[model samples]
Target: MSHAKLFHPKTPEQLKRAVARCARLHSGTEAGEGIELLQTSYENNAISWFLERAKELPLGDYFLWFRKASGITFEDKNEWVPELPVLAGVNMAVVGQLKEIASLSKGHLAVVSNDGRVAVVMDSYSGFLQAEPSPEEIVYELAFWNSLG
Candidate 1:
């Protein structure tokens, strides 16, 4: 997989510019590789009536953008489906134990039924911005993920 350097931004304008650049870079790839860009703002939730809530957006916040987006849809917000079909324009799948995804770089994630068709996932987002993998490397990783399954 090819690795690319990430340009982290501290301002909204910089984030938008980075997103636009990612959009352009990803447009040249194959049709089935979906992409998304996400902004990670830490939030805290309270459980029941006994817990207190806390939230914070880091001083130097990180934006994780996906080079290949997914298009998996759900009928019920709490429902889960494994092995969603590959969309026509995007073939990357968000495997492992993820419940919801936020934004996409390109096409939506879909479920390919046993008969072979596409079912798009709605209200979800995929793509993370962190130090683990650069945006370019993420694209390669998605490609590998698509190829494997």
Candidate 2:
């Protein structure tokens, strides 16, 4: 299942280059096939568009969530579970994904590559740069699906 938080590479620039290499490699000359296991979906040669946006995306703490029309956070029941924050006057919500998050994650790490695609990875023998929309479109996409329900 997709996690409730976001994660990215500890080394953004290096990861960016790795993704570029993934794009340039001859078809079937790829490294990560199990990249599909990283997230929920897979698309071959899908890194181009995401790479463009993520290329210069500076490392920053990015927290993307949807504030319900009622202002309840996480879109949970309004009166049932009042534990979730109101998301309105809150001075600080939970900490967001930090720049060095990769190192901090024990496993099931989520790395947002170029643009918004996410690669939930564990360093494999093949390589990185496995990306997809597979619920990996985080932050700006954070509350995306939640909105529909």
**Which residue segments of model 2 deviate by more than 4 Å?**
1-11, 24-26, 37-149
Model 2's TM-score against the true structure: 0.19
Q: Which candidate is the best by lDDT?
A: 2
Clashes of each: 34, 2
Residue 43, candidate 2: alpha-carbon lDDT: 24
On the 0 to 100 scale, the lDDT of residue 40 in model 1 is 24
Residue 65, candidate 1: alpha-carbon lDDT? 33
Instruction: Report the C-alpha lDDT of model 2 over 23-48, residue by residue, as the tens digit.
Output: 33333455533233122232222222
Candidates' C-alpha lDDT? 0.24, 0.27
